[model samples]
Target: MHKQFSDVDTVRAELLQNLVDDGETVTNLGSITRLEVVSRIEEVTKKIISSLSMEEAPVLTLKSRSRWSNVRFSKLVGLLLTMGGTVSTLRSDCPSTVMKFALILKALSAIYKLVQSDSYVTKRDIYYNDPQLFGSQKTLDTIVDDISCLLKVPRRSLHVCASTKGLISGDLCYLEEDGTRVDCTSTVVPVSSSVSGIINIVSSAKFVLVIEKDATFQRLVDDEFCINFYPCIIITGKGVPDVNSRLMVKKLWETLHIPVFALMDADPHGIEIMCIYKYGSISMAFEAPTLTVSSMLWLGLLPSDIESLGLPQDALIPLTVADERKLNNIKKRPYMSFHPAWEKEMELMLRWKQKAEIESLVSIAPHFLTRVYLHNKLSYGGWI
Candidate 1:
């Protein structure tokens, strides 16, 4: 638990205090339930309410780089990943700032209501709560994520719950905020806000396995992978992971002290998702210290394994134009050049111009993935 800010309560209270100190009334904030903004509200007052004086910029950092192969991996907890950044609203004339400045104040105001009511609102709720100002759900989401990064608090603590998008199962059980005891052993569990409150995780599992796709996750479940081979927890984000999924995995690793392995498609998007698990995403880089699982290793579906393992050639899909575009973007990323293994895989993919899905393992046999591929990969120590 690398908490950058004070506890959740303290942060929520401070947000409310800022609103009251700036003389913003409930009516001035507008209709939170109907997503309407009343006219004649002071935008200048909103900006003033949003900007806060800071003793220092955020003391968090991530694995970022400037040039090829120049990653600053040194764990400087108080330092930022990129060279320079805008922390406050005092400087910077970018047009983006004007909108973001207002959104931050709106978000803070929304959170204040949540704190006062002692309630939780989903991202969708907040989006619908103020569509006039938010414009789109994505805009609201980006602002909320930026707020979480800036405030140094988990989004859940800010009373924002992203629509849960991952599943979990295994020799594990936990309690939610409202005293709901969940037993994950016998069912596929949708991850709740396990990170926000007291999570009394009960598990005797050896390790946790995080799969990238829902199809592969279902395949493993159909094969009873966790029950037959090992006493372990299994999870999937279904695609690009959500915050709840990442947070659940981090909490499991920290609390259970078990090795966590990620299985993903042998493609740029897949690798990027896993990297977000191992290292925080560039957008949310500031929260890396609290969210990332640095020791999490890649399990399989590597590019070289496509040919080396002798899987059916028909199972491989040639890289599409869109896939190539994504690969090129990932290659240009500063952090990509630092890891030799990742760089090697990226090069191999570029050279071969092909990718494989975890489902490809099923070509060997229906249950080949869980029974053979993974078992052999683990037994032979074939993971990074």
Candidate 2:
């Protein structure tokens, strides 16, 4: 894609001019080493020490990630905290922020030990280590993210990880940090405990399928969906996904350069889950660079397919008040404008006020998902 410039900075600057155009997925700067992680931590600590001695208040400044004022929607990056979003300073002297400041330091200290030893621990593990000081898991989680953003490094880079919540099965194989070779071909494995340490990834899969619910994921496995299909990988985070699962999906897409697809039931929540895999959520948007998969295509169980498939209307569930409200919110999302096909499916769901689970298709025939529905979709290019 480089036509003229051979210099790295010049090429990067030229490419960045349109980096966020349309539906391009954002990528992180790359992995940081143990020494670099330690160095950054020391540097931040030194800055705070410098601030403590000076007229400065030893405050930690970071973007207000939770507030809507900090979030903006872009077709290129989904809903993310803008570079110029509202900033809040955590002051060491303020009574309100003193505990918060202590928590940040505590997290940093814990990170220093982890990086120094090249050890990995989950956020839950860190919380349990000093629950009294952390107060709760949420408190620990927040500070970890704050430290991550402040250090301009991913949480995983700090050696803090999420507890595994997703399962994967497919033609993929890889070696984890401890040099454990995992072959998902024979059995479904939990997503890597340390995604950053994974290496030697190999896969012959033509595509990846992200499932909404674990029950649905298991159902496919029982049907040998992985064996019979177009040699694809399947993953599920149960319902709402954790960071590791998102990271795995991003990694697979980047490495394989294969089409990624999402299959959710025809409902507002299902659509939202699909969006989370395709476009990063506003809550964790700061990590969008490493989490989102913009190429993820909407696969089966679409609302528009409900009538045309000739499925029984009697079994279909009518949308509840909450579902209608959620659907409206989904339609209004700024990224929705870039996806009229998705929007049309959503509009149809709202109009009919009916929803169906991916399981609902099973009534047509046993193993219909692998045997018929998904097969047709993948074979004939039926995905959106």
Candidate 3:
């Protein structure tokens, strides 16, 4: 009462030949329901799997009615081998060939399971290599390290739940061994004066003043000059701003709409430091555009000030060849392209190969700064 059907290979060959004869490129074949066809294919695959010494079993190919069909069958067999533990054994026995294939298939399966399952792996568990080499271990480890360091959490127990029914995004909390929840982010502790001092200044200041050297700030404070200035905050030492400091400064300037003024020495290094503060230092991981002062407002020792102060000619700092090239290259910048005043300053510096410090000028009489000499002649000309 039943009609005989061809085996998988015969059916596949027939289908392919039919495609070639009709000049139709077979994109796919309809769902295969024939029991005889499936049985024959399964038998062939089982024989292939059994024939290869466990070491070679993973690379076996299957005959199918279409390319898609072959791919699906191969994946299915790989899944089976992975689940059956034969894949791991084969990998362990022969590492170079079978091991790599098994590891790849297992990784894919793990990822698929991760996506499909309701339970999610934490950012910590996924990173830790306790299980074995899996999906992007190095990348995962680096991410975990960064988050742990930034949030100041112990790496061993840090875990973040996926946004489900109740959890908020980016909320890192602590979890116990038995999965009890503790709100680490909620506990408010006393804020340090250094942090609070900066915050208070940000809150009150119309424009924040950032000074590089501690001694300069000390001199300003000691002289009791403009101590009533609410918004002026000084950064001590020569180091670039850290992440927390950069973020705080950016938030004050950008979010609060406050202007920022930076004071530093007049040398190449000082200029570079100010630029880095505004544009972000390459060494530090932090970046914020709002934290920089305008280069046009750069003040300190002008070339004329150096000559007028009667400071030793030897006090002028020398410019390297690289510095000369950098000065010349500034002409090409969109913001600073071709200023005669800037060119003249560069020419003077190159001629003498000397650099001047802001402290030198700051150490001079205030009358000199306020009256007889301005930081830059260009400022007086209204070119800035």
- Each prediction's Cα lDDT score? 0.69, 0.81, 0.38
> What is the full ranking by lDDT, best candidate first?
2, 1, 3
With a 3 Å backbone cut-off (N, CA, C), the pairs that clash in candidate 1 are none
Off by over 4 Å in 3: 1-206, 228-231, 237-239, 255-258, 281-286, 289-296, 307-314, 320-335, 338-344, 362-384
State each model's C-alpha RMSD to the native.
Answer: 9.9, 5.0, 22.1
Compared with the true structure, what per-residue lDDT tens digits does model 2 show for residues 253-349? 7777677789898898999998888887776776666787766788878997899888898769999999999999888877887889988898899
What's the TM-score of each model vs. the native?
0.76, 0.88, 0.40
lDDT of 1 by residue, 1-384 (tens): 111112323433443444355343332111133122211123333434354343332122212222323222322111123333333442223564556656766886777667556577898998897799899999988877765544444456566788988999989998887898989886898987555564788998877889999999888788788888878899998898888888888778767878888999999889888877876656665455456676677888888898888878899889988888888887776555556787788789989999999888878888888888889877777776
Sorted on TM-score, best first, the list reads: 2, 1, 3
Evaluate candidate 1 by giving its C-alpha RMSD to the native, one decimal. 9.9
**What is residue 329's positional error in candidate 3, in angstroms?**
5.9
lDDT measured at residue 335 in model 3 versus the true structure, 0 to 100: 34
